[model samples]
Target: MSPSLLAALLYAALTLLLLMTIAALRATLVITRQRTADAFTPAGDDVSPFSGRLCRAHANCCENLPVFGVLVVTAALSGHADITDPTALWVVAARVGQTVTHLGSGRRRAIRLRFLFMLVQIALLTTWAARLLWGAMQ
Candidate 1:
């Protein structure tokens, strides 16, 4: 498989890991009788600060996955995976960095760092898409 495809799969795995974390945290709360299962909100603030961050992180992944996936898959389908391969793994690394920074702290510096990581992913993906488009036009 191409590195671009592998990167996309890694991104999916990371997203799933975040989801499982939310589930485990909620389950622990319910089991301890600290809260009811139905009491959890989509915003996750009803639970804890970390839960809220977790929700946001998971949502971020969900939002960006398709954007990255479409580009990677399209490149592969059109035999342009080479265009995306160089920086594809870097995008995934940046994504993980963003999520870790998000979950690590709510401080200003952490937020800034998280935003930087997000920008890296966007820049890489945007460049990849442009290259793919240019290649297809040839």
Candidate 2:
């Protein structure tokens, strides 16, 4: 029930989420590349996702992981264990939104919602970190 424990849990969850997202993104890239090449064969046809700038889905997830992990650890060390439950929930929500955004049919909407959730989660975590630091300085 301690804040530190909660923070640890959150950190673990965040790490797992980031790893899963990276795996999914890599798989998508591999599949797309294979299909593209196959379609371009002499007797094959063009069949692939639209050709354009690569999606940043996995990159974004990786980028956020460090921030989330650091905040959780900082909060735990600062004795703000009370914020763990909510922080973990927010992290879960953000991960859900991320998955949807990455693979859902309505990508634009999903991405928007995912980003919004991510912002909310980050704000909550930042607040927790600040509180922990403030408490330590007091």
Candidate 3:
């Protein structure tokens, strides 16, 4: 696989890891009788605050992952991996930053940082898309 493809897989794996973490957290809570497990919805009165953070973080990743995956996969498939590879690395960095920031705090500064990270990802993906489209137009 090309670097872009590898990065895309790593991105998906990391997102999967985030989701599985929430599942494990819920499972542990249910096992300990800390909370009862529920399907589909993330927020619940029975869940702990720490678990709530995990849930929300997982939800955030879930919302963002599809677009990122699509763009990266398109780049790899369309033979524009060379242009996308660096962008993918930067996006991965920003995505991790966003997740970590979200986990740490929801304060003004943290929210700003999270937004910045998200913007970085959006810009990187947009760049990748533009480059791919531009190349295809040739």
Candidate 4:
């Protein structure tokens, strides 16, 4: 598989992992035998902070995955991957960093770091697309 496609798959897999984390956390909190349906039915009643962070992280992943997927797929099919490969690598790395920072959310510095990582990934994506476009126009 092309490296850009591989990177896109990696991001998709990471998003799935985040989703599973949220699901697992919710299950642990909501599926206890001692609790009735009423107690667990409503959100924000007893969700863990970590679970909340995981939720946000998953949300963020969902928000970015579509664009990233499109860009990576286009790059993979473009046949001009000189910039795409490095951009893919950098974007994946930045995504990992963002996920880690998001998992450690709630701190000011952590939030800032997450934003920085997200910006880096966005920048890489833009660069990848621009390179592909430029190559196509040549």
TM-score each candidate. Answer: 0.96, 0.58, 0.86, 0.84
Find the number of clashing residue pairs for candidate 3: 0
Give me the overall lDDT of model 2.
0.56
- Give the Cα error of residue 73 in candidate 4, in Å: 1.0
**Runs in model 1 lying further than 4 Å from the true structure:** none
User: What is the per-residue lDDT of model 3 for residues 24-123, given as tens digits with 9 covering 90 to 100?
Assistant: 8767877888665654355632455555666777777778778877877787777677888766777888888988888788689998999999999888
Per-residue error at 35 for model 1, in Å? 1.0
In the range 21-138, model 4's lDDT, one tens digit per residue, is: 7666566655775444455422332566776677777788888899888777676666665667766867888988998887877799998998899999878888777877787788
lDDT of 4 at 64: 88
TM-score of 2: 0.58
Model 1: per-residue Cα lDDT at residue 96: 100
Best by lDDT: 1
Candidate 1 RMSD computed on C-alpha atoms after optimal superposition onto the true structure: 0.9
Error of 2 at 128 (Å): 1.6
Candidate 1 per-residue lDDT, tens place, 4-86, comes to 98999999999999999999999999999999989999989778898899999999999999999999989888878878898
lDDT of each: 0.93, 0.56, 0.77, 0.76
Query: Model 2: runs farther than 4 Å from truth?
Result: 1-55, 105-107
Model 3 deviation from native, Cα RMSD in Å: 2.1
Ranking by lDDT: 1, 3, 4, 2
How far residue 54's Cα lies from its native spot in candidate 4, in Å, is: 0.5
As for model 4, its CA RMSD to the true structure in angstroms is 2.7
